[model samples]
Target chain A: MTSEHAPIIEMRNIEKHFGSVIALAGVSVDVFPGECHCLLGDNGAGKSTFIKTMSGVHKPTAGEIMFEGKPMHFADPRDAISAGIATVHQHLAMIPLMSVSRNFFMGNEPVKKVGPLKLFDHDYANNVTMEEMRKMGINLRGPDQAVGTLSGGERQTVAIARAVHFGAKVLILDEPTSALGVRQTANVLATIDKVRKQGIAVVFITHNVRHALAVGDRFTVLNRGKTLGTAQRGQITPEELQDMMAGGQEMVALEGSLGGTV
Target chain B: MTDTAQTPEQDERVKEISSFRKALIRPELGGICGTVIVFLFFAIFAGNSGMFNSQGVLNWSTVSAQFMIIAVGACLLMIAGEFDLSVGSMIGFAGMMIAIFSVSLGWPVWLAIILAFLICMSIGALNGYIVIKTGLPSFIVTLAFLFILRGFTIFIPQQLENRTIIGGIADAAEGDWLAPLFGGQVGGWFFEFLGERGLIEVFERGTRAGEPVVDGIPMLIIWALVLVAFGHFLLTRTQFGNWIFAAGGDAEAARNSGVPVNAVKIKMFIMTAFCATVFATCQVMEFGSAAADRGILKEFEAIIAVVIGGALLTGGYGSVIGAALGALIFGVVQQGLFFTGVESSLFRVFLGVILLLAVILNTYIRRLITGER
Candidate 1:
């Protein structure tokens, strides 16, 4: 797939530093259209910093980002969003007390002109929300139902469906399944597969190698703010990927010191 | 396929919601129930006390209108996840400013009113700015302003005229263009004609006879109704209303989604100040004077009315209609106790009880929404 398709987003040697701490040291990843690119790393291995830089939450201290073959700089998250790069964060960016339709159109509400006043078009918003959620394979009770009432997977689906509907050419999902149950995680993986089939580039960030392999086309491993390697789906085994995630040689040394299997 | 077919049955999301549960989810549920219960109690206890008469109705409605004005502002601000404890002080300060400008400085009544609004709203904006910039809770910031503004309300007039209370505003504003809007009556001719037709009671043994007991509706009630309508429309229909809910429900999430949470909160703060000024303007016009103690404890009253109207203390999840109903309940109960020959001080007891019930109801509703036990 990588051989035949051009990368939609190319992060070339991206590095981000916070005063004295180096969060990302020249890390690079490429996302091609219609493919799931998994970024696997243990906790504190620069996964968050790398994605934040890629999604424009932080400016890269060094290195360039090429979007559709053109060098681009995102001033903020909004800039990246307008350029069709949407990031579904770990926190999900949803108002739980609000209705599904309202959350769907939180910032970009559709309005209809009634005399001199511009009113939120509830009918349009409701129909669109229902239809979009239906297409995502989650049948909502009603558009007016609160987001908090939905299961974790359904909420994650709502967030993903929202990003895809809003013209996200490249979707960056950050630890979406971290808080989900086993069934919920499978649902999320299925949703990811559906999203990839729609020809949108997906950057799926996770620490679980099994979850990554379930839907990912390519795997990129990061350790201690540096990339260990990138491999095609068939080239990397689960145990090999898990070993790399645990800092390979470092895990071996820890096991020897403990004199027991971990 | 089996899983998909079984989802509607196994999952609670698609299950049929009970009608009782549905009714409990309404933001106005508590307020409507309280209003109905209060009205019924008053009707039975004060049946022949003329509490439902035209004059008595006017009295309670006017009082309710005052609460509605401030509660509308508080409702919107609470929905946007902030509090303005300085509302009571703002009312007193605004009235003092208007009196000082119009009565003492010989300024036109209209200009004085506008200037007071400007000053109060600027202070409101400053409150919001400090909260947003400093990342401080609005409760602390507005609490500080509450004392500061109250102190100034007393200090300013005392320094200017060697007294805290100022009079002569009615005489100064007699012919001013804007005085009529704040201190005027409407539909007087209709009431007078009704009195002439023997449809209503008239002044019988006085110097003037055949005058209706209720002449016309006061502008205060009119202002309350208009503000309620406008606030309801803004909360339910506009895009800004959605932003208000999002800002309150999850500000960080709203910000990430580009809702401009700070701007919404600041604008809501200005709105509260605007409401407080309106309240003050109407009070001064009606009383014909301004006093430092005019609006003491009014801020708490407004908050209580809003809370009883089903607005959560933590912000988000409220309605303007609910707030109006809560205000209506306050008006009826405060006036009803006097009509029923009960101790007027018992009104505070009613407020405390009702507030507790409303909070409990709101918590239950929140649990239902969040699907928590």
Candidate 2:
């Protein structure tokens, strides 16, 4: 993709903190349409912090977020959603006991009128959610199945389908496959691919290097409150990416300094 | 995971009711079982002399009606993830308001009942307002209301020259205008203790086996059934009920999902108050008297009914039908104990057992339901 393609969502100079601990600092990333932008980091490397900032679960201490090239500040998660931003958290923000239809259209439930009486139209919600899931090649039981009965990968697929159904332009996924087994992780990655093909920009946050390499078009690494860098597919290899994210050079310097002191 | 290859249609049906078998172990189901146990004990211990007696059934129904009415609204509040401790005192206050107005001020009974209902509803609304505006724990707010209502009941009677009983409300079966206003007398057989408010009749049935069944059933039972049915329909069929469940399930999630949690909560609080008002009306009108002591510990009974009905104290899961059955279970215990020759004073111990048992059963059911997935 060239600079000619306007990014769907762009964050500039984002900063966040919790008391005296700086969670993120001056992190910048852009998500282009039909592209997978992976935000990579090790534990405590500000990846979760970045996702929260983007999802409006937490406001940046200082930064500008541009959606469709328009400046805005989201007051809360709902605001972000209305602006066509949605998230599939690692924890899977869905009621497991509720039916798949309920979980999929939870925030945006469908309703119909019967002789001026407003009623919950289960049929519509069911068909639409099930159809959307089916379109994504996610086969399962009927829409009325309890979400809790689904596999981790299937639930993630439902979450992605939900975000897409809600008209999300910039989808942010926080380690969607982190809890899945090997084959399940592959299934979720396939979902990420399907999501991108729908022309929605995706911010894929993950610690798994192989998974990211398989799906990511642009990669941004976060290390201790700052952006290490953003690179195109050709700009970095999977091994080099792993080394940088793991603090390969930084660890060497720290070890040298400690050794000199001893 | 079923052994059968489910067609889409069959799968749809199964998905819709995959939890059908699980209901057998639900908390309310256990309460239903307990009701059977208590009834069997009564039948065996006292036989027709106690278990199948006409007066016995009427006695239990009357007592349980209070909890059923109050618990219906409490169930709504609980579904919205809140509580109301002031219902008992609200009952007293409502009764007193009618007594003071109809007796001392010489106001008509009809006006007094209307005024009493309105006042109760207003207080309920006020409680809701305070809860939402401050975002405080509803437990404390309702407890405070309980104390406030109790205080007024105690202090106001003495100031009014002990004339809290007017036109036959104090002494049961006095001809207070309230009696006929609720339901008229039936051929030599009227609940005269509340007095003839005006001989109004709400239910009637043909003689069964040549028994004239005067008005046949308690007006309170009919009302409870109506309200319970209405409440059940609302929870299962309406958007508002959906909102209540969502709100209780997770307030933050609901808010993000576009539910008006604060406004809905306030509305639920008021609904509870309105229910309390209805119970007070029935009790006062039936006995043709209204006074401060009319409502006592009834609020706790309502909450207990809710919990026993399968509602979680921690909020966000239960049914209105469950609450109604819970009240029935409670009714059985209270009335059945009389047949079992248990001391009325030990009712608290019996209730404690039910409470503990309901909690244990509820936890297990919840685990079973959620963990199965």
What are the per-model numbers of colliding residue pairs? 0, 19
- Stretches of candidate 1 exceeding 4 Å from the true structure: A253-262, B1-13, B18-24, B370-373
Measured by DockQ, the strongest candidate is 1
> Model 1 Cα displacement at A127 (Å)?
0.8
lDDT of 1 by residue, B1-373 (tens): 1122123423453678888877667878888788888999999999899899888899999999999999999999999999999999999999999999998898999999999999999999999999999999999999999999999999999999989999999998888899878888899999899889987777897776778999999999999999999999999899999999999998988877778899999999999999999999999999999999988988988988998898878887888999999899998999999999899899889877877887788667776775544
Q: Give the fraction of reference interface contacts each candidate recovers.
A: 0.54, 0.21
TM-score quality measure for candidate 1: 0.95
Lowest summed-lDDT stretch of 10 residues in model 2 chain B? B1-10
Cα lDDT, model 1, residue B122: 100
lDDT of 2 by residue, B35-127 (tens): 676667677876766456555777788777767989999998998889999999998888777777777677777777789888888899899
